[model samples]
Target: MAFENPSRERIGDILASAGNIAIVGLSDKSDRTSYMVAYAMQNKGYRIIPVNPMVDGEILGEKCYHSLAEIPEPVDIVNVFRRSEFCAELAREAAAIGAKVLWLQQGVVSQEAAEIAAEAGMTAIMDRCIKVEEAITMQGRTRKTQ
Candidate 1:
């Protein structure tokens, strides 16, 4: 069977309920898309955990974890900025870490990865930007509203 992304409403609900977002492949450079998206999500009140083996220190004032398994706290969403080819492994890692959602950023899509996440009982979202979704969902709500 083919994979389908969640509805906008479902995505909104997922975003609304999510508090801790573990950003995989997050870049330390300010110009990178991963950095920008993570920055926006952080500003919107989500706890952004930077997951990158390359970085030694913080990216956005938060501790950088080498991998998903290293994050001590529960991760509500595993927001990935890596390429589609890397998602299946990340999906397995996300499942192992008990993440509620596997969100593949824009331009990244993988049916195999989505299936892996779904089989693990997680909401798998592919080819969508979390920052864009958050903005779209928060269209009418005030900043204080969540």
Candidate 2:
């Protein structure tokens, strides 16, 4: 069964409360999509942990984690930048690590994976940009802080 998406408002709260993010499939190259998106999220105050196997060193000032399972600290969000077909595996890892959210980046979606996440009681969001959702759904809070 397909899972219901947590509303953008709820996603805002998740993103707001989330302390660290494990960006799966992140690249070491500065020009990569994962790099740019991670940069944006990092600028927005989210601690983005890069998880690309090819890169032995750090990117964007954060220590690179080889895998989600290798991350010693708690990861509040598991952001998948890979294709839809691979989300299920990532979803399983997220659930095992007790992650609170599974976020599929734009153009990535997997109903099966979402279902698995939901079964594990994790909030599931597919095919959406975290930055965009934060800008739109958290307007009320944004106004208050301004």
TM-score of 1: 0.95
lDDT tens digits, residues 38-135, model 2? 88888877788888777787989888877899889888889998999999999999999999899999899999889889899988899987767767
Against the true structure, whose TM-score is highest? 1
- Deviation in angstroms for 91 in model 2? 0.5
Model 1 misplaced regions, further than 4 Å = 141-146
Colliding pairs, model 2: none
Q: Give each model a TM-score.
A: 0.95, 0.90
Window of ten residues with lowest summed lDDT in model 2:
137-146
Q: Which candidate is the best by lDDT?
A: 1
